[model samples]
Target: MGLLGFFTRKPHERAGFELYSAAVGAARRPGFFAGLGVPDTLDGRFDLVSLHVALLIRRLRRDAAAEGPKLAQAVFDAMFADMDVNLREMGVGDLVVGKRVKRMWEAFHGRAAAYEAAIDAGDLAALEAALTRNIWRGEVVPEGAAARLASYAQALAERLAPQAMADFTRGRARFDVEVPA
Candidate 1:
């Protein structure tokens, strides 16, 4: 590759990382665990991140612009790459890293599919059920927790869908800052 190519910023790459960062930011909102009763464990955190990323990807897929698909794929790739780094940092051995990453990918795909279906159906009940099953890991959730999270996800999706692709590519995509009480 030429020096110019090396130095030039790739729009999709920037957008992908931006989206992932946004997802992480949303997931880290303390209210999700404190007010909403989402477990504060590693798996719980992963579930939140997965949910946010799935919502972003869903919006990207629905976009009809020429760059949508490419950007979406880049975002997905960025997510897995982050997951790989995280696993390694947690002391996962090289020999099993590939297997662990594969499992994470499978989990992501499953969550994405379920989220897409619920969002498409436009049913809060379906969204709540999906969150309860996946994020809460099938345990009995505190009253209204799933419903609150479902509302948050729907609000986030609505906010993301109307954003211009250029904003995302420029690393200016925004998620709602207010966490549900």
Candidate 2:
């Protein structure tokens, strides 16, 4: 840690925060809840954001560069910070906020692991099941909603997988818009 390191902004850190913001923005897209039938509640929204963040982290981890891990950590940090702020806004007490944040971290990790495994296996059905359980909370969802959400996830992953690391580092990463069928 040198004086310059402290003074100058790191590229990975900046990119990670930008990526986090992008994920949150994507989750807030009304199409998912309105058109796709994802629940609009807090848990539903968190699951969607977690899914987006997991995808980004997965891509970053696949990069061979040393900056990949740093950027991933930064993204994770940004997510928890956002969660903490959200919890506070929802009237969570300061004393119990730590416990609630810990639980949220656990939920995020569990969802990420499940999603990664399903994606790695190349099983769309598994991914759909995971989404149903996590996003829909094991409840019966509207017909085709789970499948449509699964398709969106797959499409989004495909779009993200080919993005240039240079573009990502420059905070120019793009996600596909949900086109009406």
Candidate 3:
């Protein structure tokens, strides 16, 4: 059986979908929110990462019950760690994506050991707010980060927003075109 067996998706299909979710989820984490220089704390309207995670978990629970629990947990695990690395690597600056593949690995898994799990619902919120404020902004990201992010977003839309994804994948999505120099 393959990874998709859990979702009744074909093996290859499931692989893409899983990567899509994982990447999308990571992109929405507080780290990502901070990347755009957004404030850490607010009226809870713009914390896209937390909002999406909550909604995703809720919807998954409603849709899949038992399986949703496992999936949600896995996503939470992966996102929290991925977000951390993305932030940490940015701190060193002068990044260029292609060069830090190995560093990305150590930061993703190893750095996770340094932080504690969310102790409570409120604690999670506070933690996210603090980290978002301290880490995402005021740091420089390596080259290709934007394209990497775009790829994840594209994959996510492909999986969840099939019609939109299809349009974008086919080069029909709306965007401002830049003329070459």
Cα lDDT, all candidates: 0.87, 0.84, 0.38
TM-scores for all predictions: 0.92, 0.90, 0.31
Off by over 4 Å in 2: 1-11, 177-181
Q: Could you give me the TM-score of model 1 versus the true structure?
A: 0.92
- Candidate ranking (TM-score, best to worst): 1, 2, 3
Question: What does candidate 3's lDDT look like per residue over 1-181, in tens digits?
Answer: 7887776732223322353354354434554444444344421222334433433433343433344445545545544555456656667444544355455445433222211222123244444433343333344533443333333333332334322323322223221212111
Reference-based lDDT, residue 30, model 2: 85
Residue pairs in collision within model 3: 95-142
Separate clash counts for every candidate: 0, 0, 1
Worst 10 residues of 2 by lDDT: 172-181
Model 2 lDDT at residue 81: 83
Q: Candidate 3: lDDT of 67?
A: 47
lDDT of 3: 0.38
